[model samples]
Target: MYVGLVGCGLVGNKRARGLGSNHRLAAVADKDLTRAESLASQHSGCDYFADWQAVVGHPACEVIIVATTNDTLAEVATAAIDRNRPVLIEKPAARNSKEIEPLIEIAERNGVPVKVGFNHRFHPALIQARQIWDTGELGDLMYIRGRYGHGGRLGYEKEWRADPRIAGGGELLDQGVHLIDLSRWFAGEFADVDGYVNTYFWRMPVEDNAFMLLKTIAQQVAWLHVSCTEWKNLFSFEIFGRNGKLQIDGLGGSYGTERLTYYQMSPEMGPPATVISEYPESDDSWEMEFAYFIDCIQHGCEPQGNLKDAKAALRIVEALYEKHTSGKSVRL
Candidate 1:
């Protein structure tokens, strides 16, 4: 498959490398032509474009990947879908649910598949945890706890992420949506949401921290907190069930090693049985996620992380943002 990628930044580079051997970059685009050219130079026969629209319209592109800023995600994906091309859009998909709503409608109407980049779900530890959950080893799921954060660098406030108009809602929309999506994947639709967002350290207009409590109809809860104020980078997610518990820590790289610990309850209680598994390999979540997207494209099925999931996560984010802005709790 030939992929047309828009956004030749950090994520764009990851996407290109994650394309696997079966797919090749057919066209690459970025507002900065030099960036596009740089990426295009690395991939043989790949063309460079200054306008994303050209990549979307490129005759050789069978699939499109939109790795642009939050505000342009939906716009670029929509254009690709309009061309009857499948699209892989980076997470949050859009600035808000409102922005994603129309894209969903258009994609559905066009019968074009769109995959949202929720790559965290493909982490090795999480994948192993899902298998454990499926085996009933954890029994009935009770709740999920997730905390993910990173310390910002110098001049971080001057980046596009600090601009609400470009990055949407800050840390919540950034790393927070991954936690929200994972929660929904395990606990089902949330019936209630209670949370707040705040700007603790960064001077940006958006909040640097977000705290959330999401509950399913069965009372299964997801307590999540995402931040950019943490002096040390971290990622921790734990799932508690009636019979056992699963704890996942780190995400490789600066977040430390990736590991999962399973604690199975003893028949008589007391300490319980424990098993630990660690993944010391470099992060392959991006490649695995792109592979799933490719599978969806080949099998004529919708992606696991589609626009609907993106919209659901965005709604949770918007709810918290609303609560913080209006000084009131949002019921939904």
Candidate 2:
């Protein structure tokens, strides 16, 4: 794949790195031309552009990676799709579900696939948990609980994420979508959504903290929380099944060592059986997800984190925001 990346920020660089030797970084674009040039310089023959249109229109570019801010995601993706190019768009895909609908429609019309960057699904621990759950040993899933947060740095409130126009929503649309996507991965679509979001710490229009309780028609539940106010960075996700429980913690780096613990209920019911898996090294989810996207394109298969998944998660987000803005909060 000849990749063209837009954004040239941390995520854009990560996507370029993920491409590695297996693919080519043919072009890159960002609002900051210097940043685009810096990334493009790292790869031989890679071009830099100030406008994303040039990046997507590059004659040699076969794949597009849109890692821009929330507001521009859908616009760039739609442009790429218009050219019949497959795009790997960063999540929350867009500012809202409505913003992403045109991109999805364009992708389908062009016979191109739009892969959303829900990289958490590619985490080694979560992948293993999903595989195990698929074996039916855990029986029926009951509920899932997820907590993901990070401590903001100095001047965090002034970042693009703190701006409602740029970020769409606060932590909920940011990290919260990951939890919502993961919860859907385990328990399926959430038919009911109730949540509360508030700017408890950050001095921004967007909320710094959000709490959600989602339930499926099957009665399976997902309780999730995301925040930018946590003094200590954290990532914890627990899934309860009829026969056992799977708990995943951390996300490597500042969140600490990523690990998964499985507790199976034995007939005797005391202590049961326990198994643990830990990823003590760096995070490879970026590369893994990129590989999956490549495979999907090659095989003409539907991707795990396609536009539908992004839209589903975004729907929950919009619902929560609607509830919050309507002066309804703190409900079960």
Backbone clashes per model, in order? Answer: 0, 0
lDDT of 2 by residue, 1-332 (tens): 89999999999998888885689999999999999999999999999999999998999999999999988999899988999898999999999989988887888788897899999998899999999999999989899999999999999999999999999989999999999999988888788888798999888999999999898888788999999988999999999998999999999999989999999999888886999999997998999999999999999987988998999898899889988878663232
Best by TM-score: 1
TM-score for each prediction? 0.98, 0.98
- Report the Cα lDDT for candidate 2: 0.91
Root mean square deviation (Cα) for candidate 1: 0.9
**lDDT of candidate 1 at residue 39, scale 0 to 100:** 98
**Candidate 1, which ten residues in sequence have the lowest lDDT sum?**
323-332
User: After superposition, which runs of candidate 1 have C-alpha atoms over 4 Å from their true positions?
Assistant: none
lDDT of 1 by residue, 1-332 (tens): 99999999999999999999999999999999999999999999999999999999999999999999888998999889988999999998999999999899999999999999999999999999999998987889999999999999999999999999999879999999999999988888987778888898888898899999888888889999999998899999999999999999999999999999999998899997999999999999999999999899899998898999999999988888877778776666
- Pairs of residues at least 3 apart in sequence or in different chains that clash in candidate 1: none
Q: On a 0 to 100 scale, what is the lDDT of residue 20 in model 1?
A: 92
